[model samples]
Target: MHIIQFEGSSIIPISILTTIASSLVGWIQVKRYSELSASYILTAHEIGVIKEQASYVSSESDFSSFIRDAETAFSREHTQWIARRVANRKPK
Candidate 1:
């Protein structure tokens, strides 16, 4: 009876330790995911703004304004594409 009681008590500490470790790992993963998701959302928003600006520029007939807006939009789109690629890369 004494030996069985001792063994059971030992397992309690191990179980508690494992649970704590797992919880910490889970929290880290959640934090990382949230950060990544937020970054993606921001990039999407920037792209949307650039697209809207380009549309507005196109509606106008000034060649210089049109060229500037188009160039800005193109640069923004390229940056968004790069961000997407980086975000999707597999963790080493």
Candidate 2:
């Protein structure tokens, strides 16, 4: 570990830098970026599946079913996102 002293040895530059870096990382986690990322990836995968199904559709019923499934997937993702936000808002 390397440390630089400043202000007549009253301040440690290395410790201050470390604290700032950790605070930034903590802020990112607190913002739920990881959960948001996972949600997007999963939603994209679900949409890709729906897209593949779309190509095989040959009738109105099949198209309707695909639309329903796609809507359900979107709603599920949205609900999860809302749940995450609500969870963050609750007293902890």
TM-score list, all predictions: 0.51, 0.62
Local accuracy of candidate 1 as per-residue lDDT tens digits, 1-92: 22223643642455666778999999988997787687668767866776676655544466577677667767876786688679879999
TM match of model 2 to true structure:
0.62
lDDT assessment of candidate 1: 0.69
Model 2 misplaced regions, further than 4 Å: 1-31, 90-92
* Clashes (candidate 2): 0
Q: What C-alpha lDDT values do all the predictions have?
A: 0.69, 0.87
**Least lDDT summed over 10 consecutive residues: which range in candidate 1?**
1-10
Which candidate number maximizes lDDT? 2
Cα lDDT tens digits, model 2, 1-92, are 67787667665668789999999989989777777888899999999999899898899998898899999999999899889888779685
List ranges where model 1 is wrong by over 4 Å: 1-12, 59-92
